[model samples]
Target: MDPVTFSPPLYKQRYQFVIDLVKKYKPKKVVDLGCADCTLLWKLKFQTCIEVLAGVDINRAVITDKMYRLSPLPCEYLQPSERPLTIKLYQGSVAEKDPCTLGFDLASCIELIEHLETPVLEKFSEMVFGYMTPAIVIISTPNAEFNRLLPGLNGFRHKDHKFEWTKEEFQNWAQDVCSSYNYTVEFTGVGKGPPGTEDVGFCTQCGVFTRSYQSEGSLTADSCRDTEHSYKPIYNVVYPNLCDGTILRNTVISEVIYWAESIRKNMVECAQEDETVDNHSYQASSKSVPSVSNISQETCSTEEHVLTDTRGDNEAYKEGNTIFIPLAKLFSFSKVQKLCSSLDHLKAILSETSQVELNSDATAMILSAVEDIEEHAEACWDTSCLELGVALAECEEDWDEELCDS
Candidate 1:
């Protein structure tokens, strides 16, 4: 569970820019996404003149009871009645919707997106733009183009990164998210590259999104005004990385591992249940138990077959909506891919072989269900989950006939 080390200059520049943004848009409530170890907030609370600071990260180990017992610091500007700076720390995934009720003025997720897979990244964006809806959101990720400048840099910036995007890919994604959320985006890069490639030279790229909305009670385009600039940075923090040589664990990849383990545990339980049933039947049959040699051989063969079939079934039943074992193990990252593939294959089979005869309304419902499954697969990554698809398909009685004939 070692944390990955980041380039000092890369992080320093990123933090400085974030601090500048805070100073420009002095927000009262500040939140940091993927705030591993809460070190970033520690620096901010100590160095900046912020009224409130909160850090949220998925790492559960660092957020101890002692960490939450933050000591209050003296405030010179306090009106003998005002409380000092308030600090809150949460342990949860940034990719998921934030559980806190309080909204934030500024949210920062520094060098965290690359670690997430595509589906998780989409959810992360939705959480930021749709749920939190902060006035300003700052996100940073490694600029894949700059890897050439670093002589020792290997495949990716970190071992945990699922994929790295070029400048164009990152900008395209940012533009789409901003447009969907009514925000304007500005891009900046950190680190030096070749002299001529200023735009793509930075080892890390950051995007600043400011929310823009139309005037209250006015729907006209002319009435819309940019309001994000009203917020200014209240704090200027400068601190070197001061933690011990502890490598940050990749929560993103660990999530996948945890998922796989859960699936395996369920499969094991299912197998044990089946074995118990078999044992009961054998005992009731009025026959003595098998010899030790026979029992050992039988146990070995059954276990070997179960293990072999579990893996083989996943690969072999790729086109089916149901499988003997957990469907999630069929795909590398998410189950949605497998579901999509199965749906597409089902469509092709129907088109080439036989077709279900249904009324217009029933056909519409079936088609709508297909679309729903696609979106559901993407959001939940539920693999081999075709309950909706099958239910909708069965709405037309002719489907059963057509399927049997095919």
Candidate 2:
């Protein structure tokens, strides 16, 4: 079957969001979990400097010889010669593959959770988080609230989907998984509408878990929904903060910061070790070679110093200097920054208002932050950055009154 033919409209938007995140991380090797036709892998190959982009899927139909010929766009776009990107397709299940063994820098499971049984979902999470040491993993699934908004009961029913989850359910489940395995959890989405809209029906939630790391739980679903829903739409988009450009920019900045810090720490450690070794060597050699050479007095000493300096310069050439920063760490810093800024903004608004009561001040603060981020994200147009900017702008349209107040 042609995957795109039956796919939802929001798939494009979701794909763009995932691709942006991947680019921000700049993974050297990317593994797409449950990649139906690897359309996302093909698109992401163009956006980031990924050396290896591989897709794993259970459906053999999507990867057959005929399908490769039939679906030329994805393959053509992924061709290294044409685009400076390399992609590999693997037909299998994510649970079966060990990401650590594969040495993937980053991995993604987009819109694949609803199809798995609970046990399978748990296993899948373990494989990605436990076995796969990828610094960053992106997972997205349908929001139950949006599913309810579908035309009828039939809307929630998908032939392949084992189960659909409400926003609360997915959040709760994700929090547990992240907490168990030391991963940070974040929630965001695509499209413009009220709490739920058909065009942006699916809820794109990304669980960015790092190895053996934990963060204090901040906002709960009820609290978040209360704040988010009370704040009326300023434009066509629902939650302006979740816009694509803002997300991409935030992710990119955070990744850079994280990598920079890691590099600095490693350099400091290496320098300390080098100093210790030099001190030990000098102490031991002091006895073998007289502190002051018994040369032809001053003239011999001057000639010996010059030769020592030359030898020192040549010795420096023997040591190689190379910098290495894991791609996942580099990309995640931007995500951390964006998410931190967003949470801070949310906290600032919440602090100004009563927990039981939602006020206009809180709404205004949210709108202001969204606008500020959107303004700053103008330069990033590759992939879905431009479209995301427009979406956030439209969501802000409903906040005109709030903007005026500010």
Q: What C-alpha lDDT values do all the predictions have?
A: 0.56, 0.53
| Per-residue lDDT of candidate 2, residues 1-406 (tens digit) | 1121223567888887777777677777787777776577657656636656667777767654332421224333212121233445555566553322246777788888888887888778776776555677777776666544444457555788888777677779888877777777777766444432455444444455444543232233443443322121111112222223344343333333334444545555677798899899889988887864553588977986785578531121111233333233332344444444554443343343221122244221111111222232233223333554465466456456555673
The numbered model that scores best in TM-score is: 1
lDDT of 2: 0.53
Model 1 lDDT tens row, 1-406: 2222445555777887788888888887788887776656766765454667877766656655345334333232111112235566666666665345135778998988998888999988887887677788899998898776666778997899998889999999999998887899999866666556575557788899998963233222232232211111222211111110110011121233344334444545676799899888877763664543555777888997786678642331211222222323323335334222453332332233211211232211011211222343233322212332243245334544543553
C-alpha lDDT (0 to 100) for residue 57 of candidate 2: 73
Question: What C-alpha lDDT, on a 0 to 100 scale, does residue 284 get in candidate 2?
Answer: 91
Q: After superposition, how far is residue 209 of candidate 2 from its true place, in Å?
A: 3.8
- Which portions of model 2 show Cα errors greater than 4 Å? 1-8, 65-85, 99-101, 194-206, 210-406
lDDT accuracy of residue 102 in candidate 2:
47
> Which candidate number would show the highest lDDT if scored against the true structure?
1
Error of 2 at 281 (Å): 83
